[model samples]
Each structure stands twice: as C-alpha cells, then as structure tokens.
Target chain A: MRKKPIPGLSLLLAVLLVAEGCAPRIPGLERTSTTEAAAVRADDEDTWLKAHYRDGRVAIFDSWQVLQRTVEGDGVLLGADRDTLAVGPFVVPLDSFVLFETDRLTPGRSAPGLAVMTVVIGVVGFLCALNPKACFGSCPTFYAGGDGDEHLVAEGFSSSVTPTLEATDLDALWRVRPVDGVVVLQMKNEALETHAIRHADLLAVPRGPGERVLADGAGAFRAVSGLNPPAAGIAAEGDIAELLRAPDAKERTSLADSFDLATREVIDLRFDAPATGDLGLVVRSRQSLMSTYLFYHALSLLGAEAGSCLALLERGGMGGAQSLLQPSEALGFIEVQLPDGAGGWRTVGEVGETGPLALNVHLLPLPAGCDASRVRLRLTKGHWRLDWVALATLGEAREAVRLPPSAALRDGFDDPETLDTLRDPDHVLAALPGDAVSLVYELPPGDGDWELFLEARGWYLEWMRQEWLGSPDLAAASRLLGDPAGSLRRLAPAYKSVESGMEEIFWGSRYVRAAR
Target chain B: MSARRASIAAAAAALVLGGCAGAPGPRGYLSTAPEVVHTARGGWVKVVRSSADATFGSQLVVEGELLAAGADTLHVLTGTGPLTVVRAPRDRVTLVGLHNRAGERALASLGLSILSLSNGWYSVITMPLNWLVGIVESHTQSRVGVLEIRDGPWDACRTHARFPQGMPPGLDPQRLTLHWYWPSAPRGFSTPR
Candidate 1:
C-alpha cells in the first residue's frame, strides 16, 4: 500500500514559496558591461553618471576589515607588487584584500520580511505562556473571608494592618482605639493583664458616668523654700512641673539648690478630692531624666485624710534609658494616702507600677469618709521625679480627657469618602499627657499593597536650647516655637510597635486571571 | 521515491532555496583595471584598499584635492593643510564601487521571510533543509566601480585643484566631497561640472 501525502503541509509549503517569490527587492547599484560602460562615457557627464552610478558613489574596502575613503589625487600608476596596496597612510596587503565598493542597493524594508518578524514575535509569546513560572513566578495567594472580604495571608506585597485585637476576649470598651495603646483588664478571677482589644471589644463594655478632675498635680501648686527648690511650673507642657536633675553629688543633697530629689525634701501641692464618695487618684510620673541605669527611687503621697496626716510610699526603678521602654518599667507607682487617726499617714490602697509617663494611667483609691484636701509628694526612700496627679470618682469616668489634634497622626488620604470613620485621633491623644504626642490610624482596607512607611517630625528642646546658648541661629527661634523633627525620629517607630504589637493582620486579596 | 516521499522532498527543497536567497555579499573591494572611472575636474572621491587577513589588515584610502600628479606619484592637498602623496602604478590601483541588483535583493528578501517562518507548522520538515541551504548559498554579490586616471600635466592638475570662488581661505577643502551643481556652492559656480 502507498503512503498518503499531507495536504495541509503541501499547502503551507506552497504558500511560503509564493510569499518568498513576491518579496520586495532592495534598491542597490548594478555593474554595467564594457559595452554599456562605453556608451555611458559617450553621453553627457550628468546624464551618464545619473544613469549608471548613484550620487553617493564612494570607494569602500574590505581588508581584514573594510576601510573606505574618497578618491582625491589623480591616478599615477605606481609599483605593481602583489604584496600591498598603500593609499596615503593606509596599507592594504593583497592576502587580506576582500573588496571595495561604491553605492550598492542594500535591502530595503520588505512586507514579507515584516510578516515573518510578526510570526517570530507570536512564537515567543506562545513560549512565554508555556513556561508560566517565567511569566508569573510565585504569584501571591489570597483567601476570601467569611464576610466576602479578601484576606491576603502571605505572598503578596502590601502594607501591614495595625492589629486592634490579637488574642483574648475583653468586655471593656473604649471611645477610640489606641494606636499603640493598651487597656488594663482586671478580670473577675483576680487576674490582671494588659490587652490590645479591637474597637469592637471596647464598644462591648458599658459606658461609665461623666467624670471630673478632682486634683491635678500639673495645676498651680506652691513650692516650699525649706528644701532644695525643684523646678516647678509646667516643666513639660501638659505635664506637672517637677525637679529634673542629673545624678550629680552636688545636686543629690537636700541642701543643694538644684536638688532633683533628696531625703525628706517635700513638695506641697493642694488638690480637692471628692468630699464623701468613693474616690480614686491617678498619678502620672516618670524618672526626672530618662536614663538607662538609674538608682531605685521611692515616692510618698502625703495628704490629709479625715482630719489626720497620711503617707503612702511607693518604690520603683527606671528601666532601659533607650527611647522605647516598657510601660511598667518606665512608670512609677501610685499610692493612696489616708489618715491613721493619730495624726500619722497610712496607706489605704495602692496600684502597682503605672505605664510610661503620658502613656499609661496609674489609679489610687481613697478611703471612705475621707475629706480630700491638701496633698504632698515627698522624697521618702529614694529619689523621684513627678509629672502630674489627678483624682476621679472610682468607676465614674468612662472616657479619658480629649486631647488636641496633631498633624503627625492624621492620615495622608484626607478624603472623607475613603477615611475610616471609626477612628478618632482626638480621643487617643487626650488619654496621654505629655509635651510629645503620638497619632495612629487603622489603615483602610483595599488601598493597594501595604508597605511600612513611617514619617516622624519633632525637635529636641535641650538641643534647641544648646543651639541658642551657642550662636543663636534662626533654627533656635524655630526650635522655641516647636520643632517636630527630633520627636518624630524618636517616637514614631516606638509607638507603631506599641499599637501594632507583633501580630500580623491580613486585610484583602485580589484575583488575577491566568494567561492562556 | 513514493508519492508521499516525493512531495516531502519537494517541500524541503523549496524551503532550502527560499531561506538562502537573502544573504548579503562582501562590502567592497579594490580593482586594477577599471572599465569606467569618471571624476569631475574638481570632484571629491574616496579610495579603499584590501589587506591580508581581511579582518586585521589596515586599508586606508585618502581623500583630498588633485594637487599634483607625476608618472610615479600623485600629491594631493588634505583637509588639515597637509599634503598627502600616493604611489600609483598604471592599471595597478583603482577605486571599486559596489551596488546590488534589484532582482537579487527581492530574492534575498523572500528567502529571509521563509527562514523567519521556521516556527510555522511546516517548519518541522523545512527548518533543517532551510538551514543547510542557507549555509551554502547565503551571500549576494555587490557591484564594483573601477577608478580611471585623468590625462593631465602636474601644473594643470594644480590649477584644477584651486578652491572654488567664495570658499573660505586656508580652510581645508579635502574633507568635502565635490559634487556637480551643489546647491550650497557660490552663486556663480553652482554647477561644478
């Protein structure tokens, strides 16, 4: 039996052959025969040259390579040694001699050639589709959530989500979610732990009654002259003024004029607490100078309780001097001073170490039937630097003080349409009292990929003063007003970790169609 | 051969021929006996010479005015104010011009198109055949121009080499290619021919 010829193959072959046959010719010069050359020479110079040679006729040579130059001097027929051809400085040996040329019809653009190039491009595209790994290496995977929201677990480029609640269930509620803020939950089981709950969790707790400030150490307080005068009068804006001195021998003594804290050195501050109801005091304190290795200091709150003198002493140590310190290590203890009825001070109830100054709140509960009036924080056991103190009825104040708005915390996207309406920057700012402020936002979902971008702005007051003490440049004037550059660099990152913690929160995912 | 084999053979041959047609030839060469060499009285010309090891040898061609020509040597004024002397033997050194015919170019282009279609369905059968033929018959020839000597005395040659009117004085004229009737020439001497 005879084998059959493939008709499709034959058709394709014929088509290619015809296409090649119809290809456009490239324009170039052609050599004329001797007779034709004679005829050309007989004609007028212009006509003959135009008809026979191209306008751009110049000699080009190929030695080991092609070297081209124009004909200048008239021919003088020299030595015919088959070894080399010397034209001015150039020497062309006969052995390597290839060829020389004038104008030649080089290939011009061809329609057929273009079609072939297109086919080549198509083939490349097909090959690329075959090896998908080359086209889409390690494409990101996304999981759709139960709410129909896409969640990207891993493998996608995106900005990080600030976790509101990572683990555990909290029944308490907050007006505004703290960026790097935490909530202390005193469980019914007598267990106390800090929790980073979501805004939803904070809403679960019932709102408390209105609150009023009973006593604020940052308020107007008269300083006594018997001991070393500690710097008073709002040293750090929004914070109570207290002595801040480096650990120097001359400054450590009670008699020294610049004593930061000394034994028996007392500061008389007057505050009106609730007369007859259950009341609590919140004390905000940090080490005078933020130092890494510092001696342990004890603070005693002395106040009149039911017509008697009372003193509550609390001792604590400062942790790492670095910019980022834990709340427990950075904050001092809060003491509730009550009267012992024999003209002596007695401790009624006391709260453990508070959070960092301007970060966490320290609460102290007053005794029943106590007449809240004058209070003093004296250096009892060790040295201490005080920030401020405030009193409120226990469980009465539900919300913290509303703080001023700061531009650093504002989101870049100011458009109300895309803004996360649930976030309130003012509420979070009011909770912490200090010269420095931190603003955090829960980035909206589906704003493309998330990337870590931190921008901080603030200036250091000490550095500014030093500049002023030196030559007094314009920068000093700006620093006096407020320089955010220094503070931004120091605080933004610390606060981000505080707010986000270490847990990863995935937001949305996207689906992309595979290439055919 | 069987019918199927014959058909396959014909297709293979077509592919081979179609692929080899567009190969280009050598760029240029020098000639000893040129048939027609036409140079205007004061025209610009370039000469190229071939050397051994075609890739390594240096072949330099001079471009300048026809200053002076003798029986064994020709002195030409260069563009940079230097005079270059070239030794020429009768019917020994000539400038070759090159050109490609239209027909040959068309064929070559067609061949290229076919070879580029190597990814097509029929390419499985035609690719090897086209490659083989392409290797054998790729190059296309270029036309060559023969340099002819002008019959004139050395003094007359110098007179012919004078810078045209309005040409800047002391400006090297050899760098320019002299053409007939250059539009940018001085008003009176527009047609150098």
Candidate 2:
C-alpha cells in the first residue's frame, strides 16, 4: 500500500516533542523582596525541588550528580547521604531562556550524554530521510558514476544501509556543541529566577544561540531572574549618508524658540532659585543679566512658594519700613538698643498685595541685607526642573515658591499633567512659605566645625547644607562637584534629604585645619 | 463512578493541588529580611490596608545662633542672660543696666562698647562703674536694642520694662506663640481605618 502523508499531524507532533523536551520548574528558588519573587525547574520526572536556607543564609551542601530530564513536569531526585535531598519546583520567568549541558553517552557504557559519532550519523541520515527527492534519481547502490564520486557506488550498497553522510566540515551549520556541566543564566531585575545545581569541578563551554551565559562551576548553581528586564532591542546608531533637508524659516524659528525655552527652564531650576523683589532690586542691584535670567527661572520653579511683592516690602531686616515707603510713604519707626549700641532704622523698599504673602523689604547700603542678598530661582514650569538663579538685593523667598515640598511630593511621576501645572509663576509663588519656617525645615551641623543656618526668607539660607566658619569660593564648589578623585567631589551637593523635608545644596565649609 | 473514572479524577485533583503548592515564601536577603516574615506567618496571604488621622496644632519655633555684625546691622543672640543690649547715641555708654534678675543687682564687671562711628555721628562712650548711668545720660530720640546674650538673669531679660511691649508690631515673640499642635504622623502610615 502506498503511504499517504498526514497534513497537520507532523506539526502537532513537533510542537509536542519540543514542549516535552523543555526542563521542569524548581521550587523554593524564588527571589522574594518587598515587592517580587522567582522560581526554577528540571524536566525528567514529575517531582518538586526546594532550595534550602538556614539562619537567613543560603545553605551550601555537598554535590551529588543526577540525570537531568528534558520533559515537562519531570523532576530528578538528587540523593544526599543515602537520603532524598530537597526537591525544587522550577518555573522559568516568562520570556527567559536557560542554557544547559547534557551528558555524553558512549558505546557499551550507556552514558547520560549524546554520543558524538551517533549525533553525526543521525544528522546526515535525517537530512536524507527528509528529502527523498534528492536521492530518487540514483539506485540504492552506487559505483563511481556522478563525475568523480568515490567509494562504493549507491547501486551496490544495501537498501538498509541508511546512507549516512556526515557534514563534519560544516562547523557553521552546527548549533549545539558539547559542554562540560557549565551554563550561564541571565534574568532581568523585573523577572523571575531559575535554578540549576552546580558540581564542584565543572566548567562550561560556549554553545547554542541567544545570549549564552557560561558558568565557572563550583556549587549547586541557581540563577534567579532579576526584577528588571534586559533592553528589548538595540536602537540604530551609526553615521548615515548625508541627505539635504531644510525647514522653513517660520518652522525653524518656532523650533528654536521652543529649544531656547527648554534650555532656559532647565538652567533656571538647576542653577538658580528666585528673587523676592523686582529682578533688578536684589543683590546690591549689581547682578548680571545671566544671573537675573537664572533668578527668574528659579522663581518659576518655586511655584506658589515664592511670596508676593508686599511681603518683601515689610521685612524690617532689609532696611526697615521707612526704606520701603517709596522714599515718601510715611512709616512707623522705632529703634531699640543694638549690640554695638546706637543703631538707626531706615526702610529700603516694599512691593506686593496687602495680604500676608505680600513682600516688603527695607534695604540698607551694600552690607545691610548681605545675608539675604542673593535671589535664588527654581523651575516653576514643566515639573520641578530647577535651572537658573540670580543674586539680587532681595533673596529667593518669592521665587522658591515653585518647588515647595508638599506639591512636589504629590506630583504624579512621568505624567505631563503634573509638568503643566508647574509652569505658571503665580502658582509657583503661591506654593512658597509666607514666612521663614516653611522655607527651612531643618539645619544640621556640617563636617564637625561648620555651622549651617537658614536665612529667614533668604535664598542662600534655603539652600544652605552646611556653612563653614569660612565660606568657600564658587570655584571651590565647582571643584567639589567635578572632581573624581574623592567621593566628596562626586557627592551631589543637592538632594531632598529624607530625614528633613528640605531641598538643599551644600555650600562650602570653613577649613578649620587651615584656620588653625 | 467507575474505578477507572475515579482514578483519573484523583490524578486531575492532584495536578490542581500540586499546581497551587509551594506558593512563594518570605525572602532573606541582605542583612535584614524585611517585614515579610511577620506578614507571611498567616497562610494564604491577605492584603493589609492602611489608614491615617490628622490632628491640628498652633505654632512652631526654630532656634539658631546669630553670627557677627553686618554693615549697618547688629545681630543679637538671645538665648542667655542680659539678652537685651540697649544702644545709645553716646557710642558706648549703656544707659540703664537693668540687673533686676539678680535680685535687682547688676553685674559690676559687665560693660558695653561701640566699635565704629558711622553716618549717625554722635559721641559714643561706655559706663563701667554703674549699670543705670547710660540710660539716664544718653540723649537720642530713637534707640536700637540688640538682643545679645540670651542666658542670664531671667527676671532682667523677661522684665516688661526692657521691651516697649508693642515694638516689632506683628507677632510678639514673648507673648503670641500660636502654639501649633498638629500630629506629625504622616498620612496613610497606620493600620487599616
């Protein structure tokens, strides 16, 4: 009877065989954290395995070899001291691959691994069996007939010979190679881990396809998947052929404007805080344009934390109510005893709505408001990106309103809506503290000798991490952030300290030893 | 059911039960094995809920030391004795050394001084022999009181006469302590409500 080929049976059989050939899951090998877990497997017999942990540590045990099964739900019983050791249930984290080695089998002694000679012959014969059309033109036995064909002819060979042809020379065609009990497994931080026992003296050789990991082999090996995954794919990189492209002037301008704005915003929040008075009024009125820009940006980042103009005016420390009265506004004045004796009162300026948040500051000549001189600015637009700062006579009380702790802590992560709400300066200022305490939550001593104080309603005070008896210059600060030789250099001066709810940047300390 | 059917059913049930077996257990990594142990003791884990309650308060105070004198400015550290130092036009002459704290007795060794002569040129002097000498002599329409030493005779520092009682105009550090009394326990940090 002529053989009739079955349509889908082969495909179904192939899938079943592949599925059955996979390893089984191992148990108790999972990674457990505050958030996640993992497991591993073996595939010969239907059993479970458990990793042993004692006294909060993973137990290291003597190794015993057992045959690994290549069928689902099968577990191998690894005996220890004439008794069954812990059984593990292995489940590979989905979308992960495990590379492993199998034992080599030999003639007469049925070793667990596949025989090299047998594999060679099996591969050649399989190709021939699958493609009968290639051999149909010739007889079963062959004598040198096709051009210079060697050896006994196919016509003379027996029909049961199976006609083997080993392609040993084609190393490129081979995917699996012999390995000696070694394997490397890689899993992501976001995924599960797998388990595989390691022998004392086994070493692995590289073979197979996707992302192979070779082991150094010493103990029972288990590779738990990491919680994070490897990047899915690589992005394209490399120089491309030049192609002429030009945009319209209008479009270009728009793009340029957008880019400029972005850069400005970034610089504003990152480098500067905000000012309390008009941009030109603070810092001895001697601030540069760049500093002014930075100051405004910092103000934007502060959101509502920045105070109103009127509040700035009322600050007696600036000069007193008299200095703020537009040189004509009548003021209530009083002078008490000063430490040095014989002090006077004078108002500088005041600007704002009459409410508590209003800003009014009295300005003295150069050094009167020195402590509160520099105006710091933060990014009030597009999330909490602190980019710029300016030093003005008035400090950052008005500009720091953008990134107040309460609102910053509540903004949604990675959301654009949160970014949108942070852009408006008025809203930013509103978030700022009306008084001093809100601006300064905590102040800790620095490096033993340096003392840090929060300048009430002052930008420098707000960002003060630790101030040494002697202040370090701006260049020294830059060195601290840029130097790689020391950890202090690499240490970020600014961070929201969890213990104290304050956004702080470290200012230089006094060199006590130098002073001594 | 037939015996064969029962055997098959038994295998199916075993498979189901086995699938659910070995649910993940607590982990032991790093030095401390998180609070998972307390949570895992209960079989068939249950999700716990969280809650929070708020209590309001009056006011808060921040304390720190004042450093050095600035140009046209005088900083007073007021945590100790003789907290108030009255400045007079005669440079260093302290008008009235109100030592009422030490049973109305003033420290004879304590004296006041003026270092610089600025825009408001007026003769500056110090009275070493007596405490109330400068208060009776210095003639100035306005006086700048710098609260210097904070610790001392409490009675003298807290004396109502030393302060005009209505000076700074806004919040009286001596009287109007709003005393904010809010609970600091963060929201959603407690057991289920």
Measured by TM-score, the strongest candidate is 1
Candidate 2 on A270-377: residue-level lDDT in tens? Answer: 112323333222100001112112222223333343333213423543343222222111111111111222243222332211100001111212234222222222
Model 1 C-alpha lDDT per residue in residues A1-516, reported as the tens digit of each score:
998999868976765665455645443333322212223222221111211112111222211122242222212111111112233323333222122222223343333433333343344334323222122211111112222222211111111011111211111111123333322111110001111111111211122223222212221111111111223322212223332221111111112112221223444344533444665555433222211111100100111120111011011111212111221123233345545667866655544221111111234555665755544444422223343454445433322222211222221323331122213322211111111112233333332211111111111100011111233233322231133234222333433342221111100001211100
Each candidate's fnat, listed in order, reads 0.03, 0.00
Docking quality class, candidate 1: incorrect
Residues B62-130, model 1: lDDT tens digits:
554443344444444334433544543222223223223323433443454354332222232233434
lDDT of 1 at A480: 17
Candidate 2, CAPRI quality class derived from DockQ = incorrect
| Candidate 2 vs. true structure, TM-score | 0.13
Listed models, DockQ each: 0.02, 0.00
TM-score, every prediction: 0.22, 0.13
Q: How displaced is residue A296 in candidate 1, in Å?
A: 14
